[model samples]
Target: MNKKTKFITIGIIAIFSFTSLFIFSFIFFPNLQTSINSSNDNGRTLQEEVSNITIIIDYSGVKDNEIYSNITLINFNTTVYHAILNCSEIKVQDYG
Candidate 1:
């Protein structure tokens, strides 16, 4: 092909190769816990059992005003409401 067409074809191939590599890395490596786990499979790590949570609150009397941020961990028994309370200082009337 011409000079310009050849350069364009090379650029497209490079981009495609980069995109494919990025996608495959995630597909194979997956998550941090997987890498940390032992290959022998004696037992699962604590990281695998617990979850990472991030709570965002926006109550500035305006739209999309995220004032408070809380990052905490929760087990199987932890409720969603309790998770939020752990992250922020807010008033909630509980009728139980």
Candidate 2:
């Protein structure tokens, strides 16, 4: 082939390759986004969902010290699953 044809062929091939990559990314973008955004997931964040709570009473009456009664512990297992399911279902339903 002539130099011009070879250059044109190479250019076309390059363009097609670029376009193919772009289209492929487009097709796989949601999954990729899911994986990437999943790694840095905002969904699995430490939200304030209290699961188990315990209150402590000090008979010594230490008013100067903070009481453990005010402390609250949250377990994410139940809430995370429910929240994830909710968001996934909402996304599937195309809801904002």
Candidate 3:
């Protein structure tokens, strides 16, 4: 092949490699949230109201491979969380 043709091919290959590198190297993000469940299971009839206890373990810190998690209770159900909080090697910092 001619020197000019070979140089053009090399230049095109270099441009594509550099462009791909530039596109992937700067400020990329991990797509999470797109991974969570979107479907809902109400498990209640139309006349019966839905009952669910949504609790958030807010303000948690882990020490010695154990979690010190806080509970933020959002009650949607008529029933109560009668079960006492239990954990192994728990250091109850504070309950809000």
Candidate 4:
């Protein structure tokens, strides 16, 4: 094989070897994997629970004519997913 073709083949083999090792490590080391308690209200992982939240905000109420050029307008909407807190290992305090 030519020098260029040999180099390309070696590069591909190196990438595949590294990827296989990474995936094998995760499978062999169970503790290295991140896991959440399955006893939560929804039997989903933390990432899955967080991804289920949907929040929408409307900024159309703020008109450009009402604000000065020097002023900066910022708006946001907050959403709390109670499902994430329903885990058996979590404890919530009420200040009120």
Highest-scoring model, lDDT: 1
Judging by TM-score, tell me the better candidate of 1 and 4: 1
Candidate 2 lDDT over 4-88, as tens digits, reads 9999999999999999998888876745646434555564555556544333334475554323322334454445345444333
User: Candidate 1, residues 1-96: lDDT per residue as tens digits?
Assistant: 999999999999999999998887778776635544566475534432234655667667776755444345556435556667666666978899
TM-score per prediction, in order, is 0.33, 0.37, 0.28, 0.30
Candidate no. 1 TM-score: 0.33
Candidate 3 global lDDT: 0.46
Which structure is stronger by lDDT: 3 or 4? 4
Q: How close is candidate 4 to the true structure, as a TM-score?
A: 0.30
- Clashing pairs in model 4, backbone N/Cα/C closer than 3 A: none
Q: Rank the candidates by TM-score, best first.
A: 2, 1, 4, 3
Name the TM-score of candidate 3: 0.28
lDDT of 4 by residue, 1-96 (tens): 999999999999999999989888877775764446646655453332223343333347684322212222122212243432332134678999
lDDT of 1 at 22: 83
Q: How many backbone clashes can be found in candidate 4? A: 0
TM-score of 2: 0.37
Best by TM-score: 2
Off by over 4 Å in 3: 27-96
lDDT of 1 at 42: 55
Q: Residues 1-96, candidate 3: write the lDDT tens digits.
A: 999999999999999999877766653533423423445344332222322334344444553343334423333322223212433333456778
lDDT score for residue 65 of model 2: 32
